[model samples]
Target: MTRPIIGRVAPEQWRSTGATAPGQRTVGEPGTARIAVDLLGGDHAPAVVVDGALRAVQDDPSLHLILVGPAEATDAVFAALEPAQRHRITVVLGDSAVRAVAEGRADAVVSAGDTAVTVVSATRALGCWPGVRRPPLAAVLPTATGHLVLLDVGSTVDPDAETLAVHARLGAAYATAVHDVPEPRVGLLTIGTEPGKGDRLRRAMPRRLAGLPRYIGLVEGHDVVLGEAADVVVTDGFTGNVLLKALEASYSRLGGPESTRAAVLLGVKGVVVVCHGAATGADLAGGIAFAADLHRRAAIAAIVTSLSDNPVLTYNEVSHD
Candidate 1:
């Protein structure tokens, strides 16, 4: 499948992408979180979204939800919560939830929609950080020893070596900022750790990553499962996305995947979380919680501060790899 390139789209055009909605309640309180959710996102959208929204409200007492989608879907959310529970809930009737983030109507945004569409919406809405050509999706998973951070997970499906290198920096910063890991050891995920093995992108990455913080050369798939290899692993979106899905599936079949089902969209200026298309009610709820935590922790701003001095990935022959 051809991946959606991170194009330079105007905010007006980006917000023009439409969905159904008629509006519902509008309320906000102190300590309350305002998250704009794509009502029509995911395979079993409105239903699962409604379930997730309701569950999130139940889980987080200070949480406030902004349901964006069809009027019917928003109504479902209203029906689930009582009059007292409705005080923290608001309704926006549209698929333009990303616009809420851009306009500062909400603190963050969550979607289980098309990865390309969601990425385009957020990047167009919130803009990208300086020197960030491609905004990769970074997912944190539980490893055997500790936790692992994987980048380029379905955001930039086909990125160049430099893009992957940039993602390495972004992923490392993410570990340091959100995961609270100091001096994260970064690794390039490829078929082999041996020098001169794997594809052109993998071969070119070591040199670029060498300049970044705590880079430990190449790492393999098993390294991602075992926390001993590296704290952060960078790969192309195609490989990262495939690996994430396969692992999620395998873990789910055995019992269930990690509690956090959402992948953080890194390299963007605002807080945006992307849940898998197959995400269930619980998974979507987890995404909502994850977004709320990032907002509260100011994860994006913290990551920028952590990577302030790192050299941006420079384009060269690696762009063609």
Candidate 2:
């Protein structure tokens, strides 16, 4: 199938009806959040996606949804809701979810569809922050102490040291802004804590990350669950994705702290949440809820503010091996 053309709406026109200006922090009615969901996303689309959308509205009275997909699929959601609840939903027949956000029809987007598609669409529609060549997907994982942010989970699989360094800065800002960590300790994930332990990419990261205020050297895989070494763990997308899925599966069978089965895309101008393609109704609902929470809290704006306050070193500025 051909990729959908996104970003038809110009950036200046984003949220024409909202009180806030484009690219500014979005402030909506207290507790009110409008999230656009991609109904055709996920392996078991429309069906599970419809179920998730219903669950989300039922759970949050102040939450609004913009369902993007075929009429038949969205009809399922409408059928499942009461007349009074139906007003909370807005239907967009066959449009990309990201487009709804860019067009100012939705506050955020949730998709269990193709990761690459969602990332590309969001980057085009919302644009990226300054110096972010490739955006990273940041996932919050529950740890023994509390929770730590794990980033680059399937965004740039073959990232360079420079990309990883950028993600480290992004993760630090996310932990500070969203998790409320006063001073986030950033760590590079590698095979061992010893110097020069990991692959070529890992070995090259310390030099790139040296300027970061809270760089904590290398961390082992176990450090992810322990949460002792750092508040934010940075890795290339390939390793982060594999580690995240493995831990999710382990937690599922062995019973561990319940972590959201969703990841938020960082470095973009808008709030976008992504779930696994095989996500269930409950997972999709969680993703939708997660997106809503981010919108209500003005997370993107806060993170951007944090980054602006403490500027991250750009990849071009640092010397390469």
Candidate 3:
């Protein structure tokens, strides 16, 4: 069986730095993962961020959080923590959070602010993989059948034909890396399964994605719910995000998965997760866990390797080009 890394932090020196929450100490353990939380990125700002950080520390002994935002908010989080438990938490400025990952200060980043800002900051800070022009956000949804991979959930809204093709490659690689699915089947999301159903972008993708990886023909909205047509489903951000939210709402009404709050930012240099802008403490906690899971599994690195190994077909060389 494939033994995936499920979010274990690395061993590092424990440093209290500067925290005045009574018994504040540092619990730096070997294999401890330090996550940088974006305090001002969510709708609720510092309040939810504070609650989530505390919950994360309480749930995992080896987890540490670098609260990134205004000092006042982070201080509030520290104030609420018991002095002894405070050792596991650190407060970093928001501007420094992305840099912390690039500078080797944090293992992963979770943000719920403007999706565009997070994407830009992460891409600029962490950098995108080679040939990854438009990075896609890949979300994992639990279907009645099984877990499904959906890409471009909130990134690349105005993607071109080439961009959709690139997302297909990234999604397939992600499935192989994280889902451990060999030769992952890819499906292009369209309004209907019939030929020429979607706009120009969708029509152009099938021909390009074919023969690259295990590209299946066009799949409709129902395919995403069924989870049988493809292991990785590709769509533009506008459609994907709306569909995801609608489905999530439906699932909430009918009661599907217990938790659905984590999504990996694919095509970037490092692992990053974008949770719901209105995520609760528990939802944020789930995002943290998901980020950790990706880090341990080396999902992003593995996907990069796969993409490199199997480069996308050049423009001129493509069949319909």
Enumerate clash totals for all models, in the order shown. Answer: 2, 0, 10
Model 3: lDDT of residue 239: 92
Summarize candidate 1's per-residue lDDT along 1-321 as a digit string, tens digits.
Answer: 111123322222221111211232233345667788888888998889878888898999878777776555554555565665556556555657787777766778999999899998888888887767788999998788878998888888779877887788888888988888878999889887689999987887788888765889989998988779899989999999899888877777888436487899998879999999988999999999999889888888888777763444222311332
Candidate number with greatest lDDT: 2
Global lDDT of each model?
0.77, 0.82, 0.74
List runs of model 1 lying over 4 Å from the truth.
1-30, 75-81, 309-321
- Is 1 or 3 the stronger prediction by TM-score? 3
Q: How far is candidate 2 from the true structure (C-alpha RMSD, Å)?
A: 5.9
What is the TM-score (0 to 1) of candidate 3?
0.86
Error of 1 at 146 (Å): 1.2
Descending-TM-score candidate ranking: 2, 3, 1
**lDDT of model 2, residue 166:** 82
Q: Model 3 clash tally?
A: 10
- How do the predictions measure up, each by TM-score? 0.85, 0.87, 0.86
User: On lDDT, who's better, 1 or 3?
Assistant: 1
For model 3, residues 1-321, the per-residue Cα lDDT tens digits are: 121122322222122453211133333245577777787778887788777877787887778777666545554555566756657776643453565576667778888778888889889989876667778988988876887899889888999888788788778888877888878888998888888788888878888787675788888889999898889899999899998888888888987775457677887878788988988888888888787677767677787666656555332322232
